[model samples]
Target: MKHKKYQITCPYCDSPALFRPASMVHGSSVLEKGRYLYICSRWPACDSYVAAHKKGKRPMGTLANKELRHKRMLAHRALEELQQSMHMEKWAVYLWLQGHLHLNEEQAHIGLFSEQMCEQVISLCRQLIRTSTGTTA
Candidate 1:
């Protein structure tokens, strides 16, 4: 069976973002050359983009602005810290988080999360870390 291409949209502007090579994304800026992403056609004005998988056209997440991107990064770091301290497989961590967030397997991705959801993940992971370490707030 043929798979459908992922559709990406700018969460901020609600505009249709297009998938293109990173080289064509920002008119010769330094942005991890050779990668691909879905970028808003409005570009610098819209300031939203979503990275695609290294080898495919599939988007890793919804399009994000600078703030959302930073939150996502923080959420990822928190998850990483929790995973390391708990000595759990990444998938196991994801499964637990998905259950906590009440998301289905296919819909439970940090990258696809909104800024609020990212913050929730970070907060929950910090709590998990403290609980696992037997430390009290």
Candidate 2:
């Protein structure tokens, strides 16, 4: 296994988290995969979870529910698009986000973003993309 499990708390329901195989959360299709999860004990009802880090017994970030998870993914994709379209390095893009979004280095991580913050980042990314591509429309 790549990662070990650790206890965490779910932000949504304030429930303690449980360490389980990814299959438990993602279903049996992922049973053979070597990933772990920290899920809310009140799952199904609370529906919050986070993936573990590959190298250690730590979570990737604070546990979030499905809606926040989707927003995070979209926010991450927006950052990726910015990196490619602007020909910026990953660190450079993060620095750019920190500046444009008024976030500190720690708060700039997409995993820690709120839905509104994710939307703000997406908008900034779009602006950068349009500016770099020289296509306002």
Candidate 3:
């Protein structure tokens, strides 16, 4: 895979981000999405990590702690439901976000959003759903 290089640093703790095998980070590679993770050196204490490409050479996004990761997941769900309900293509949903959230293409992805951005996105999605369906969301 042609992957972009990243100079990743821990977002929570200012520790060095190290490329480690999924086995080292998750204790098992089974069911993992990628072959490795960019884990914070603080590891258990900081609890920050990001998935890497299949070759384990490039970071997927900025490092996220547990809470941020959970928020991102919620953001993803909100975005998905909006697209499915609206019968819009995946890119169409993103285009809506680009307009409402004032986000550029690179910043429009949920995976790269901060916790605050995730909350904003979820709220916007709910409002959009409510308005479109004329139901409480």
Q: Which candidate gets the maximum TM-score versus the true structure?
A: 2
Off by over 4 Å in 1: 1-5, 24-31, 135-137
Residue pairs of candidate 3 with colliding backbone atoms: none
Q: Give residue 43's lDDT in candidate 3 (0 to 100).
A: 93
Give the Å shift of residue 53 in candidate 2: 0.7
Q: Write the residue-wise lDDT of candidate 1 on 46-125 in tens digits.
A: 98898888765778988889899899999999999999999999999999999899999988887799999999999999
Q: Which of the numbered candidates is closest to the native, going by highest lDDT? A: 3
Order the numbered candidates by lDDT, best leading.
3, 1, 2
TM-score of each: 0.85, 0.87, 0.86
What are the per-residue Cα lDDT tens digits for candidate 2 across 1-137?
A: 55544667888888899878888878878453878788899987888988876568578788988888999999999999889877899999999889988889987787778888989989989987887789556
lDDT of each: 0.86, 0.84, 0.86
Error of 2 at 47 (Å): 1.0
- Cα displacement (angstroms), candidate 3, residue 1, comes to 8.1
Could you tell which candidate, 2 or 3, scores higher by lDDT?
3
- Native-referenced Cα lDDT, model 2: 0.84
**Clashes by residue pair, model 2:** none
Error of 3 at 137 (Å): 19
Worst 10 residues of 3 by lDDT: 25-34
Count the clashes in each prediction: 0, 0, 0
